[model samples]
Structures are given as C-alpha cells and as structure tokens.
Target: MEKCNCRSILCTQMTSSGPHILPAVSSNSDSNLQKRYRCSLVEVIDVGVRYPPEWRKTLIMLLYAVLSTLLSSLVVVLVNNWVPAQEIVSPLPDLFPRSFGSSAWAFQLSEFCSFLLLTLWLIQWFLLRYKSIVGRRFFFILGTLHLYRTLTTYVTVLPVPSQYIICENKVSGGWEVILKQTFKLMSNGGFFLRRSPTFCGDYMYSGQAATLILTYMFIKTYSPDIFWVYQLFCWLLSVTGVVSIMFTHTHYTLDVIAAYFVTTRIFWWYHTLTNNQDIVVWKGICHGQETGNDAHG
Candidate 1:
C-alpha cells in the first residue's frame, strides 16, 4: 500500500462514542504506524481514552488556584488577628485525653503524608501525556474548594478546636506581621518546623483533608496503570493524614467531615457537568469539540 504523504499522523482512539482517528504527536519518526502504536499503548493499555492536553487551560487553572490560595492565606492572617486563641469543647477531643507530650508527632505525620501526596501529584504531572487536562481539572477543583473555604472560614470565626494546638501569638506590629504570617501559612500549610501551626481560626473545614482526598481521587480517576493495591495504599495514606489531623487537634471533627463532603461533591459535580455537553458553563473548558484534539499540548 502506498503511504499517504500527509503532514500529520493519525491514530485511532476509542472514546465513549466510538473509535475516532486523531492526530498523534511523535518526535522520533514520521511513520504513521509507529505513532499509532505508541498512542494505542497510551490510550488502550493505560488511560482507556485519549485526552489531549491543553497547556493553556492547565496554566490558567493553575493561576486560579494560586490566586485562591493566596486569598485564603490572607483571610487566615486577618481572621487570626480578630479571633483570640481559646480552645472550645468539642465532643471528639473531649472524649480523649489532652496529652501534648505524646501526640506531638501526629501533626508531623499528617504533614508528611500531605507532602508525599503533593510529590506524587507532581510526578504524575510529568509522567502523563494528557497531564494538562488532568492538571486543569485538578487545579480548578482545588481553586474552587479553597475559594469557598475563604467564605466559610471568615464569615463566623470559631474558637480554637484543640487545647494542644498552638496559635500564633497576636503581635503589636502592623501589616508586615500579617504579611509574614500569610506567607508562612501559604508556604507550608501554616506548619512551622513541622512542630507548631503558625495561624489559627480559619478552620470551618480542613484544608489538609481536602488536599489529601483530592490527590487520591485524581490519581484513581486519571491513572489506570496504577495497580489496585497502590490505589488502596493511597487511600490508606489519605485516611492516615485525616485521622492524624484529629489526633493532633488541628481541626475539629466537623471540619474534617465538611471537607470530605464538600471536596468529593465539588469534584464529581464539575466533572459531570464537563462530561455532559449540555452544560453551558463548562463548554469552554470541556473537550467535546473535535477542534480541541487537533492541537495536542
């Protein structure tokens, strides 16, 4: 058979509708067959679908995430000033003994788990071919969650949830102190030296739990090559982090529960709306149009 002298190579990918021929990106050779085989391996054996990455969308979503997080940190700093640090009576913490000496390490353990999840997410961003799309979805969800949190945390500030959890002492300085504290929270989830929390009273929901759950959900949804055992392990790690937050007395039980509900619901809702072409809100971002697949990121 005579080879077609087309500028772009075409590969077949199976989507929900049916098999569709889409352009495959290859730097090694101009051979269409070779490109097809590589794309087939990625779509068929790994991800079960071809999702062309959009670098623009990913970067935009990342910007949204950064802005939202920065806003959240700002709120934390301001709220920390208005609300004095005082432990409230909560059922979960009340049931257990308040031993600062013993449970000090649990906060460190939670931070470690969260850091590991973040590292894994970065590795995935490098490894996956359709990473831009995955990143877009992840960041959009993250930004939305954090943005909502800014409202929830600020509207009605509650007293500190745990006796052992240390809040930053209110200082006599001006905006410089607030700026320093905000940056501190943004840099390391408010943990200084992984020993004590820097800011307080921004806790209507647990950010740590939301982050861990989001990482797990994204890994499970996007990466099919990962074994079931590894997925289970990831889930177990998330559970450990969430449980550790309780032990360390960083967030109330209600905060963690709200995080789980709000995070999962928002994640699913956004994906569902995007997946259905009928939803006009996400039509700009969704990949239902054939024109999007032509430009691979």
Candidate 2:
C-alpha cells in the first residue's frame, strides 16, 4: 500500500507536466507533429539567441575576419613604409583597357552594393530582428573570404593602373584610419583617386569583387523568402562589378577572374561544412534537402 501510494504521486506529477512529455502515437505523422510542437516551444524560449553549434568555431571565424583585416591593413602599411618600396605604377598588362575611364563609377557602384547589404544586415542586428543564428555563422565565413583575398594579394604582385590612381590611405596605424579615409574619399566622390606611392602591390586579387560576390551569397543564402528577387539582384550586381573592374581599369582581367573562382570555391566549401540536420534550408547556390527539416521554413 505504501509503495502503491508513492507510485501514484509520481504519476500525478508527471501527468500534470502535460503533453510536452509526448506519448507514443499510432503513426509517424503523429510523432512528427509532436516533435515539431516541442521544437516550436523551444524556439519561443530561445528566440534571438545567436549561439551557433560550436562556439569555438564561431570564435575562430570572427578572429579570421579581424586578423585578416589587420593583416590586409598591415600589407598596406608595409607597402607604404617598406625599404625599397615598389610604388612606381607598374601597370599590369590589361588585355581589356589601356587606361581607366574618366571616373571609376562602375567600381564605386560595386562598392555601394556591398556597403548597402552590410548596412541592411547591421540594421537587422540592431533592431533585434535577425533572421537566423546560421546567418551570423555565415557572416564569419564571409569574412574569411577577405582573408583569403588579402593573402592572395601579397602572394602575387600584379600591379594595376587603378592601384596607381587610388591614393595610399595608410592603414598601418589601424583599420579605423583606412576606413575613415575610404569613407572620406567615397563622400568626396572619388572611386579611384590619383596615383600615389602608398597604394600599390595589392593588385593580384581584387578585393572589391570578393566583397561584392560574398555579400551577394550571404543575402541569397539567408533570405529564402525572397530568394529569386535577391538572387537576380545580386547576380546582376556581381556581373556588373566584374565587368566594371575592366572598365575602371582597377584590376587585371586575371585578377577579377581569379577572384570569382576563389570566392565561389570557398563559398561551396563553406556550405558543405555548414549543411547539417539542424539547418532548415540549404538555400545557396549549392543546396540539399535534409530529412526531418523543413527547407521552406
């Protein structure tokens, strides 16, 4: 009687906790329904959380972005301050254009598109209206693209005419100074400034193309609801940017071509790494439908 009374009390408490302790159902459909309902409750409690599957991995991504920025900036500084500095405009043989147009409008347009996307993302983050935790993970991977490009820039020294014209906004001090200078130049409406000694040797890989393409992928992968609209827009932007590199005479044809190839490959590699059972939609260029997950959701 004593044992029976204790067992009855335990059963009562478990029942009171409700159907969250889901009972076995007759069919697979019923089981799935219960699982989804449980997940919804969990999501409600975990909304706005930016944690990823691996905090350490995410941290490495963030660090890659920061370190890459610093290293790229360092490259700029060293180019400016190094002994026997090679700043004379050794223009890369462009099969396309001998000289830049009157204004670097096309290159600037690409920069504008990249900046616009970044601005939108920042606004979403500040408003506490971000789409998914995965998006943040992607952002870090996106950042590493810059790192790759920066390393490429130094590895192959292909001097171009635009580097000749783009003034050396020294980044040796810090990235902040370079950013300020960049913003100032943009505000003044100079995409490719007059040739300067400090702004040469970063011509092998086009950072501009990398930035625009990566941003495009980010927008497409994360915003599935408007996938077609964003994809078309981003595709147009990317093509325009690459074409502009020639017209603006900013980078060699090879540089832009290599940028596209490298960025696309890295993008593919990243998606391969991130596609998991927990992922809702693999909505980028390379995609797959994982079972037990709603792709449209």
Candidate 3:
C-alpha cells in the first residue's frame, strides 16, 4: 500500500509540470522563427550586408585586364615589325567596300561614347546607390573580352583597313617596346585628350564595339528600373559608337560582327552560370553564425 501511494504521487507531479515545460519550448521556437524572418529582411534591403567587396577577386580581375591589354599590344607591335606592309593581305572583296570614308573625328566620336558609358557607370556606383558587385562583374567581363581579343588577334593578322592609318614603327628591345606602346595608348585616355596610337593587325574583332555593347548589356541587365530616358540614351550611344567605328574603317565588317557575337555570348554565359548558385551560401549570409558555432562547438 505504501508503494502504490508513492507511484500515484509521482504521476501527479509529472502531469502538473507538463503544461509549463511545453509552453517554454513553444515560445522558444517562435522567437527563433521571428529572428530568422528579420534577418531575411535585412539581407534584401542592404546589399553590402549580404555581399562583401571581395577585394582579392577584384584585384585579380584588374591584373588580368592589364596583362591581357599589354599582351595584345605586344602582338600588334611584333606583327607590325615582322611583316612588310605590302605583304600583309587585306581580307579580299571586303564587305561594303574597303574605301569607306575614314575620318579622325569618327574614331574620336566612338571613344567619346565609350568614355561616357564609363562615366555613367561610375556615377551610378557613387551617387545612385548601385552596388560595387555589379561593377566588379563588369570589369571581369571586360578582362575576359580582352583576353579573347588577344588570342584572336595573335592567331590572325589583318592589314590596316585604311592607308591613312599610321602604324607604330618597329623599335628595339622586347618588354620596353610593349611597355612604351601600352603607356602611350593608356595616356591617350580613350582619345579624350589625344589621338590613340593606331596599332596594326588588331582587326579580327573591334574592342570599341565590344566595350560599348558590354556597357549596354550591364545597364540593361542590372538597372532595368532606372530612368527610361537614360536607358534610351544609352541605347542611342551604343548605336552611334558602333556606326562611328565602322566609318573610321579601322576594322573590317567581320570584326564588328564577331565582337557582337563573342561579347554577348560570354556575358550571358557568365551570368547564367553564376546565378544558379545558392543565394545564401554564395553571399555568405550565415558567415557569422558559422563562426559562432565553431567558437562554441
């Protein structure tokens, strides 16, 4: 009888405490859910909170761009020196006549449009609340485009389309010549301050057309909600730059055609691959939580 009485008392105690225990667990779960919801909101509103600058990757891309540009310029110089001007064959029966009205102003106009696109992208980054992530992507794409240009130009040598175009003279020394030519082109500041040195045999694809088109692609993909008028202006600028490049006769028709094809293809391919990544993992949304777990593990 004493044992039975003990069993009854223990059962009563457990039944009484059940309500309190259950409520504690239920409240804790609700609190966790609320915290997670607020975190999601912050991620969406603050891009920097979700995406760090990733300076290492940016630096790598910048270095790649510089190297590829130098390599392309080096190839131009070597080709110019190695082949006699008369021996270099122009692509025969050129599309729309090789005698296009070449003008210095046309080249300058194309460069001016490219410069404007660059300025607008910067303004968007600094003043208009665009993320640097987009800018990083732009530079990366540009570097890739230039790398492709380097390979193409190296493989196939095309004569300068216009006789009026001045090719840089052969010079002694290897690295020194590359550096000098690259410096001269860079110092020209996209033909803003001075005429860009005409590098012969860079005719498989048009870099100006590629850059202008790339700018348009970035603006269209990232900032579709931006002012419609500004968007229209960008479209107009790209068209004008492309047409202007053609009139200069620095490149054959195939060069511009290949540029459009290659640039757009690479851009779309890059985004399509990257966008498939898991959003939370790719952006490091749980980095702090992971660190805390490791510390307290």
Candidate 4:
C-alpha cells in the first residue's frame, strides 16, 4: 500500500514539471522564429527604397561648387601671366561731365563707401531671412553682373576715339598697338589676311578667353589674386541679384532657371563625367535620404 502511494506522488510531480518544461521550450522556439524572420522582411523593404529628389539636388550643388572652385583657380593662373598690368579706361560715359570738379581719389572713396554699406546691409538682411530661393536669386544676379562687366570691358576697348589717340600714328603704342595691328590684318575678310592686331582688342580678347577657359577648368589652377578678385565680384553681384529678386518677389522663378541652364551647366557636365556611381550610392545610403547621390555618380 505504501509503495503504491509513493508511485502516485511521483506521477503528480512529473505532471507539474512537464507543463513548465513544455512552455519554456515553446517560448524559446517562438523567439528564434521571430529573430530569423524579422531581419529578412526588413531587408526586402529596405532594398526597394528609392532616393529622395532633394538629395539629388544637394549632390549636384556640391559638384557645382567643387568644379567652379577648380575652374576659378585655373583662370587666376592664366590671367596673372597673360593679362597686362596697365589700367584700362572705364567704359561708362560721364553723365555729369565736369573738369577737375571732383578728384579721382575722392570720387572712388565715395563710391567704395556707398557700395560697402549697401553690400553689408543686403547681406545682413539675407542672413536674417535665410531662404534657399533667395540664395539662388542672388547667385543668378551675380552671374549677370559678371557678364555685364565682361561685355562692358570689351565695348570700352573696341571703339578707340580720335581724341584718345596719343600719338601721330593711328595705333596707340604698347600691347594695345599689337592688338590693333592684328585686327587690321584680319579685317580684310579672308581666311588669312594682312592686318595689325591692337592690344586693346586682341590682347583683351585673348586674355579674357584664356581666363574663362581656365576658370571653366578648375578654380584651384588660378592664382590667389585672380581667384579672390573674381570671387569677391561674384559674391557681391550674387548678393545684389538675390536682394533684387526677393524684393521683386521673383524667387526661384528666374534664379533657378538661370543657375541650371546658364551658370552651373559647365560644372554639372564636369561632375557628371568624373564622379563615381558606386561610391555615391553608398554615401547616399549612409547620409540618409536627404543627402544627394548625384555628386558621387
């Protein structure tokens, strides 16, 4: 009878332990199943995720900046060697013509002060607002100003007035003389004609062209003098342009159009050809969706 009772107690203990052991095993199996399936599902969805458009724009912007800097440098180097040190005459006609009314130094000082103040104010205002569209407009305006300055230089040198002739000969001496002779020789309207080139025309054109080409190549190639001067001019013009666009309420409308089509196209082409696609892809993934992919590609 005692043996039978002991067997019943043993059976009861075994039954209780069986329930606990089965639950623990099932719980472990469920956890393992979840760990295995979770990552696989995540990988499938993540692989299909597309890059955002803004990231692409940012990539393009970065490429533009790098290319432009390199080209500007190249231009400075060429300009330092090729461009003559002589000061060229200003192109603007004197609306308030007066002899000895105001000293050149005083006039220059006044102009400088005025421009400095205006630029400072404009920059302050821009920073206060900090809008991307505003920035774009500024860059566009800056490019236009550069274009104007370049064209004006050409115009001023091209039409040599009779009064401006310092010597008995039609050609003024110096580099200008060489340029005039060449132009005269070329003006005969033939594949190759006999004409003297003037410094004002030929030299100016050649220098400008060389600088433009160099700047287009890489900004780093240029000397510090050329790079800084050109960069300053560009920056001021950009600020002015942005202010005008914002005040006139023309934000991205014209600014983006001009930047993409006219200003940044050269840089864009350079980056498109040179950038690495695989690196760009990996970078884009690491930097999040907002980071651009175009720069790497």
True lDDT of residue 187, candidate 1? 80
Per-candidate Cα lDDT values, in order, are: 0.75, 0.56, 0.69, 0.33
| TM, every model | 0.70, 0.57, 0.70, 0.25
| Model 4 Cα lDDT, one tens digit per residue, 1-297 | 112122112211134345221111222345544333211111223456443334444445545543443333233222323333234533223222222122223322323433443454355435533334333333333334334334433333332211222221333356555544444433442111112222222212222222222232233212245457645654454344333322321112233233334434544444554356766787768887445565555
lDDT assessment of candidate 1: 0.75
Q: For each candidate, how many residue pairs have backbone atoms clashing (under 3 Å)?
A: 0, 3, 0, 38
The better candidate by lDDT, 3 or 4, is 3
Task: In model 2, state the lDDT of residue 294.
Answer: 60
Summarize candidate 3's per-residue lDDT along 1-297 as a digit string, tens digits: 112122112111134344211111222355543332211111234455456677677677778777766666666666666544744554345664455656778877887888898788667666534355666677788888888987888777776776666767766687776678767766565223435445577777888889889988887676656578888888899989888888877778788999999999999988976786775465575887788899999
Point out where model 1 deviates above 4 Å. 1-52, 87-102, 189-197, 279-297
- Flag the better candidate by TM-score, 1 or 4: 1
> lDDT per residue, candidate 2, 1-297, as tens digits?
112122112211123556444333323344434344322112224466454356466567667666666566556444443322236545545667754443457656656665665565455444443434454565576567657766776665554455436445445666676666545433432222333333555665777677667667766666556558756876776677667666767667787888788888888776776666344444542355443246566
CA error at residue 14 for candidate 1, angstroms: 32
Let me know the TM-score candidate 4 reaches against the reference structure.
Answer: 0.25
The whole-model C-alpha lDDT of candidate 4 against the native structure comes to: 0.33
Question: Which 10 consecutive positions of candidate 2 have the poorest summed lDDT?
Answer: 4-13
Model 1: residue 284 alpha-carbon error in angstroms: 13
Give the least accurate 10-residue stretch of model 1, judged by summed lDDT: 35-44
